[model samples]
Target: MSFNGNESSAISLAVATEMTSDYRTNNPNETKAHFFGKNKLMDILNQNGCVGIRAYYGIDADGNKQLVFVGADADEKDLYSGVILDMSAPCPSNCDNTSPLNG
Candidate 1:
């Protein structure tokens, strides 16, 4: 959980959050009722070589969790995005958008 630095993990998390937002935005009715995980994005994050960045456990959209990340490069500015991950349950590597997985 050592964010707030030029760590790749932090940046990757922020990117994943942004991607999730985009996914939801493009498909509202399909995504609003369910939360999802982007496996490839997560794979990138996991390769960041950092300890597990604790994922807050609870209903994904049950509350507000701010996702603020310091760029891995100092020249890059901070990234702020809102995300709602369904950490409440687990899904396989490829969670399809066709069927809303009730995780």
Candidate 2:
């Protein structure tokens, strides 16, 4: 999908990847043992009016686990507010930290 400057979808994917990568690198064991399902990611996308979503796990240059979430909106002008959570801090059992639309 074509993303304008700082598109929400692109930004959310980037944030997810960065958070996962950091978590994996710092906690490799956790990455292999604990699997964060795509349900949360999909919820975020769906709540934001995304018609489609794609998620993946990978390692970053720093050997960190990366979780990427990509989504597409049919309406070009459609704007989404909140769709992601901040990974900078520890998330509760519910995985609720911060809003993805924030940054």
User: Best candidate per TM-score, number?
Assistant: 2
**Clashing pairs in model 2?**
20-65, 21-64, 21-65, 21-66, 84-100
What lDDT does candidate 1 reach at residue 85? Answer: 32
Off by over 4 Å in 2: 1-34, 56-62, 75-81, 85-103
TM-score of each: 0.22, 0.31
Cα deviation in Å at residue 80, candidate 1?
42
Locate the minimum summed-lDDT window of 10 residues in model 2: 85-94
lDDT of 2 by residue, 2-84 (tens): 54434444456777767766765776554322234566655656665565544456555767555655554665433335454
- Cα lDDT of model 1 by residue, 13-98, tens digit: 55666776676677654423323346633532443333223333333365532222222223332221322233422223335555
Clash count of each predicted structure: 0, 5
Global CA lDDT computed for model 2: 0.48
Q: Report the C-alpha displacement of residue 88, candidate 2, in angstroms.
A: 14
Worst 10 residues of 1 by lDDT: 65-74
